[model samples]
Target: MLRGFYGAGAGMITQQRHSEMLNNNLANAQTPGYKGDNASIRSFPEMLMQAENVGAAPGGRNELIGSMNTGTYMQERTPNFAQGDTRQTENNTDMAIVQGDVPVNEEGNSGALFFNVANEDGDLRYTRNGSFAVDGEGFLTTAQGNYVLDDAGDEIFVNNEEFTVDAGGNVFDDDGEELATIDISFAAAPEDLVKEGDGLLAVPEDEDALPTAIGDDDINYDINQGFVEESNVDLMRTMSDMMESMRIFEANQTVLQAYDQSMERAVNDVGRLQ
Candidate 1:
């Protein structure tokens, strides 16, 4: 009976965590370049039960019973990296990257690249949010004012000369003079990247997080200058998941209540007879 109570409690805790993850995904459904996360649950190991003594055919002997499942727990929250839909902003500063040869929309091309930006502490990070603007210093920077890095890993500085960025990521002035090339870097292993807050991905400080080179045939390297990527979360799916989690949570609560009542009866009502 005690084991049953523990199992129910574990279930309630796991369900609470799952609900939290679903809520987070729902809240970020409209966030640009936002990725959804899912909670993974793992069951506790089952314990083998054995009878102290049992009767075999015409003989008394010890026998093995079955196994009993203990409970489940939240293992980890895994982020989904599937590509999101793109929206055309018609803003010259907005940009988006194409994951592969199959474009996300008509404007997309083949490429697996991300824009590199620096934080206030000068620590480099990567992002797919291409909503950029020119700062007072005539430097291309993110909305948070982080300087965008170029191919040389330097801050890209541009004057208010009506600049344009091409699919090849080259910047040009109003006079058609090539000013600077925008940096589009590829991650050799994107799975190793970890999500920091504010739509940024951070590589471990100890690992070499430099962009890996790819041949022209391998990637289209196309950059759309007037678009932004939307969050990959599916609202309908998230709603359904949320409902399911709530139901499971209520079930666990019911089990816990039943166990509590059983214990109460055993202690108060049954103990009175003694």
Candidate 2:
């Protein structure tokens, strides 16, 4: 009877954390390049549960399992690394990288872009969103204000000169000569792909940062200019998850309340008489 109360307490704390995760995912459902987060409760250890809280007899010793712990045993953020859908915005700066042959490797990167995107010591910083433009300094920037890179694998710096990025991710000056090219790719390993703030992703590590899955002989990524990657989250699917989470939370609450009531009556009516 006493064990029921403690068990319920554990559940209440776990449910609270689950609800928080659901709310956050729903809020960011429309965010571009955004990944969803998940939460889960740690299952009760069966061995511990089999032990008696007060020894085998009445009022012996309180075991760890019997102690009421109104604490959360839930994981706060389990990041969802699933890919988002790509939507074509048709903007010149908006670019989409699909699986294809790698043309120009790299030249450098530009400082003005979004998602804090920047080159990592000559290595290319990766992203799913291609929406970008050349800033006053002739540096390419994303819609949210971060630098875009050039082929030398450095931040592109044009110093206010007008330029165009061709279908091959090449940057051209007003005279039509190639100044530099964008160094983007989709060949990063699953472990190598990492998240930057606000839908931007950074290379998982600086060492061995080049695309290994692409094979070392030559570059193998094709660029689709004028298209942007779409968000991977589905509204209908998220809503279903939300409902399931809520239902489980309510069930936990019910069990906890029943336990509390039972414990109260046991202590007041029987314990008081003893």
Candidate 3:
């Protein structure tokens, strides 16, 4: 009976975590370059339930009764790295990187690529959000003012001129002079990248794992100038998931309450009978 209470409580806790993850996904559905996380639940090992005092009736052997489950826990929250839709802003400063061979509209090519940026502390990060601007020092920077990196892993500085980014991520001035190629990079397994907030991803510190630069003849993707990648979250699916999680949470709560009541009755009513 006590084990039942613990099991039900564990279930409630797992459902609560699931609900939180679903809510977070819903909240980020409209965020650009946002990825959704999937929650996984794992159950503790089951215990063998043996019949007590049944040894004398079963050839002096302990009688097998059944198995009882212990409890469950939230195992992991894995991020999904699926591509999102691209929106054309025609603003020249915005950009989007498309994946796979499918072109985004009729103007975009496809490959796995992301722009490199540095935080205020100069810690490197990667992002698909290309909404960039030139700062006071004429350095290309993200919306948060983080300097955008170039192919050489250095901050890109350009004069205030009408600039254009080509399909290969090369930047050019109004006079058609090439300035710098935007630092486009890729991880063999993008899912391995750790998610930092604000649509940025930090490369793992593992010495064996490092992001590679996008080289010529490599998988080509259009750096769609004047465009931004939207969040990949499916709104309808997320709404359905939220509703289902709520139902599961309620069910778990009911189970937990029932377990509590059973425990109460066992303590009060059964104790009084004894």
Candidate 4:
């Protein structure tokens, strides 16, 4: 009887979390370079049930009932690293990476690419967002003001917004003189990267920094100026998922209510003395 209540409560909590994830994806549907997350739900281990205080049956063993499931929970959320569609922003500072051949890891997952940036703390970070801006100090920066790094891991000084970036990721001034090359980092398993807010990704503390994708003979990619990669979230699918999650939540709530009513009866009516 108590297990019923616990199972229903766990189900509600799991659905609530799943709904939150779906809502977040829907909200970020238009965010540039955003990746959607998938929830991994798992059930608790089953417990073997047996008759209590039962004498030895035919084979001198206690009577066996069955296995009872404990409950379920949302285990983890994994980000989908699929490429988003590119839209032309018609801004010189905007850039979009068109990834081509990339090396696959032993897990059979293709690698991903990201632009290297440095936050205010001078810590290295990464992002797929290419909507860059030239600050007052002639340094290239992301929308959130992170300094965009070049191939040498130094802040790129593009001089002004008029700088043009070629398909090779080389920045050139109005006179076509190359200034610097944008640093693109490669992750053999991007799912391991932790999501920091504002479109930033960080490598785990135990892992080393990602390697540069540039000069890699096997990797092929091209940068397109005047464009940005849109978020990979699917609007209709997210809406459908949100609805399903809500329905599940409602069902769990109903089950919990039923369990509560049964408990009330057991405490009041069943325990009542003649």
Candidate 5:
């Protein structure tokens, strides 16, 4: 009975964490570039049930109850780590990086740059959100007034009020002429970038993969004028997971209750009779 109590307690704790991750995903269903988190469990080693009479000498073959039951522990935090679906929002400020690989400088993890999902400022902010807009100066800017960098490793200056992005992700002027390109490539490496909040990436100054390292001709990233990438969380899958977790929790609870009653009867009635 006592063993069952301990098992159930552990099981409850695991269930709580599972529910928490599920709730978080549901809350971010509408969030762009949102990633889901998942929970896992570990098991306790099997052992024989404690004998009723402590220190009693072994007389008969031990009935193996220990081999039948299992105790568990909550495992490490493993993210669901699946790519969200791509959504298309035809807003001039919206953008998405179709390329799966993000490059950074020599800083393995910390050097990553973060981008503003909403592109509040064209200036470099960390975010996975590719949505962006232009500033009053006609310069490619985020909502926050930060300048968007071009392929030349310089700020994409829009001296002309009219700007357009072509098939090759190049920005063109009013006469349908090519003005500049949004160059987001690296010279040394992209592996050094780390993931900051809002789906942006960042790198350190010491990192060699600076804009100067890459040549002008090397700038080859395509930028869409009026499109945005949508969030990728699958609703059906999340609901299914919720149901499964509920059933498992209920089953564990029933087992715990039965074990309690069995022990209660054995102690209250059997002990009294003796």
Candidate 6:
């Protein structure tokens, strides 16, 4: 009876976490370059049940019953790196990365591309958000004021908003003078990148910054100016998944209530033994 309570309670907690993830996806549906997360649920190891305080079997071994499951929980959450549709904003600073065929990692997962930026402490970070702006100091920066990095791992100084970025990520001023080339980083396993808030992805502390995606003949990609990539979240699917998760939560709640009632009967009627 106690095991039943534990199982039902675990199920409810798992579904609650799943629902929260789906809700987060819905909230970021309109965010540019946002990737939705998928939940992975796994069951605990099954335990072998044996008769207790009973006589030994033919060979002096306890009688074996059946296997019983403990419960389930959410194991991990992985982000989906599928590219989203690009929308033309007609703004020169806006850029969009259109990824093509790329080398797959040993895990059989395709690699991904991202724009390199420097955080407040000048630490390297990655992001797909292309809504850039030229700061007062003639340096290109993200919405959060992070410096946009060039191919040489230096900050890109465009001097003005009237600059053009070519397919090769070369930044050319209005007078046609090449200033710098935008840096595009490649992640063989993008899921390993940690998602920091404010549209930035950070490399693990123990890992080095990702390598540039340029000069790789096998890697094909294009940077489009005056455009931004939309979030890849599917609102309809997220809503449906949220509903299903809620239903499972309620089901578990009902099961837990049943267990509570059974326990009450055992304590009041069975234990009374009038």
Leading candidate by TM-score: 4
Worst 10 residues of 5 by lDDT: 109-118
Query: What's the count of clashing pairs in each model shown?
Result: 1, 37, 0, 0, 45, 0
lDDT of 4 by residue, 1-274 (tens): 8899889899889999998999889888888889999999999999999976576555555778999998899999999989899999899989988889899999898899999999889999999999989899999999989999999999999776488888889999988988999999999999999998999999999889999999999899999999999999989888988889889889989988998988888789756863
lDDT of 2: 0.59
Clashes of 5: 45
Q: 155-206 in candidate 3: lDDT tens per residue? A: 9877766699898789998888989998777665666678878878886786
Give lDDT tens digits, candidate 1, residues 158-231: 87446888877788888888877777667655545788877788887798765633344665656788888888
lDDT against the true structure, per candidate, is: 0.80, 0.59, 0.78, 0.91, 0.58, 0.93
- Global local distance difference test of model 3: 0.78
lDDT of 5 at 57: 69
Error of 4 at 269 (Å): 2.0
| Residue-level lDDT tens digits of model 2 in 1-274 | 6666666667766766776777777787766665676565676654433244566677677556443334347854555545456677766666665543333313321111112256434334556567677677667776655687654556766567766666556777788888776765443233335655555666555455443322334444445666675655677877887788778778878987887887788779987788
lDDT of 6 by residue, 146-175 (tens): 999999999999877599999889999989
Which residue runs does candidate 3 get wrong by more than 4 Å?
A: 55-60, 101-112, 216-218, 270-274
Q: Against the hidden reference, what TM-scores do the models get?
A: 0.88, 0.68, 0.88, 0.95, 0.61, 0.94
- Candidate 1 vs candidate 4: which has greater TM-score? 4
Each candidate's root-mean-square deviation in Å? 4.5, 7.6, 4.6, 1.9, 6.7, 2.0
Q: In terms of lDDT, which candidate is strongest?
A: 6
- Greater lDDT among 2 and 3 belongs to 3
lDDT of 5 by residue, 210-249 (tens): 4431234533334455655555667888889888878878
Name the regions of candidate 4 deviating beyond 4 angstroms: 55-61
* Candidate 6 similarity to native, TM-score: 0.94
The alpha-carbon lDDT assigned to residue 87 of candidate 2 equals: 74
